[model samples]
Target: MRSVRRTLRTLQGDLARDIALVLLADGIVGVSFGAITVSAGLPVWLPMLLSVLAFAGASQFLFVGIIAAGGNPVAAVLAGLLVNARHVPFGFAVGDVLGRGWRRWAGIHLMIDETVAFALAQREAERRRAAYWACGVGLFVCWNLGVVLGAVAGTVVSDTAALGLDAAFPAVLLALVLPSLRDKTTGAAALVGVAVALVATPVLPAGLPVLLALLALPIAFVLRGRLDEPAHVREEASCPSR
Candidate 1:
């Protein structure tokens, strides 16, 4: 009984730690988007709403940027949707571990980059849940707070571009992607996506490059099985010949 109680306490502590860390990271990320929203001439309330409802940081930033740059609303929506379509696969991969019923739905909605990363790092089901919820809720609160601050401060700043806030979007994306490249396929896919986006940027409309980039995701997913097999075989070969 004592051992069980001790284990429970340890788990609770770990959950708390994970939640706190996620909140901090998310808050910082939000500040970048909030600044961009302000610079893009959006109202404070608009960014706050995006932070709360849109929830996906990269998509929100891209949507606001496109709209500010004179892109059509339909284009902005399509671009944002295409950029975020990766969540579909992420949801499927983590579905079983997220459990069932309403909690599963909640998990799906909260399945952002940070939440997925923290969840994947955990070995146990209970730990995964705790970490995921921690990251999600933490990101939600901190991101909103950052948005509020940025919106307010953005008005007073003379030159947002001069401040280099434009770099924030790519920086945040790099943070998410750099950690996930465990194999050649993932690395190659990321490179291809980047190249496609860059090449399409000049030829396509402001928002269409995002859609073009998304065209690569399906290819990556289809090839994932074949890509993993080589790694698996390599690992097996490296094991002791017992």
Candidate 2:
């Protein structure tokens, strides 16, 4: 416990504060999601089940949104899978922080965009692990608690859109990734992703453009590899002098 506490303390005040703020915002949104789901005339247990089992905010929202629109449940689930396909790459990127054995499985279950971003933003492994678990576990608890509250309240509570709180998560995410954009490789990748997403938005289905944007990552990796090549080796190859 001491070690865990010490590890957590290594998070600078700013990071800890950021995590706290994001958690608060997410809890509010969770309340909104639950209230909206139940108010749409679905069973109260539906949102509770999704919150506990799916634990995916956007995907869950999309699922409920589709169902409320009279879309088929199977289609809604398939759409949720399509939206969540990004997790494959997320798993690859953040796999190191997951450790091994059952701990790894638990980490996998807790993984999300916010937690992964926090883990990636940290340099040290210990800090990465600490950030991942802290954000993931805290978010799980806060979101479920909010869901329960909203479910019980049912029609009494309104969605957060009335308060314009719906934008908090995206704003926080943009802030989290901006620092990473300072790197040449990441910057190139991000620019390409934005362009791809913009271009594909009108043509492709909702989740597909995000997947298409991920193709930008290979450009970053290739650029990084070329950049990492030895200076002398490059000079020799270029000049090929007597």
Model 1, global lDDT: 0.71
Spell out the clash pairs found in candidate 1: none
- Measured against the true structure, the TM-scores of the candidates, in listed sequence, are 0.65, 0.87
Candidate 2 lDDT trough over 10 residues, lowest sum = 154-163
Over all chains combined, what TM-score does candidate 2 have? 0.87
RMSD of 1: 5.5
lDDT by residue for model 2 (106-217), tens = 8898988899888888888888888888899889999998888888787544757776776777777787788899888889989999899889989876778989988898
Lowest-lDDT window of 10 residues in candidate 1?
A: 2-11
lDDT of each prediction vs. the true structure? 0.71, 0.86
Model 1 per-residue lDDT at 97: 60
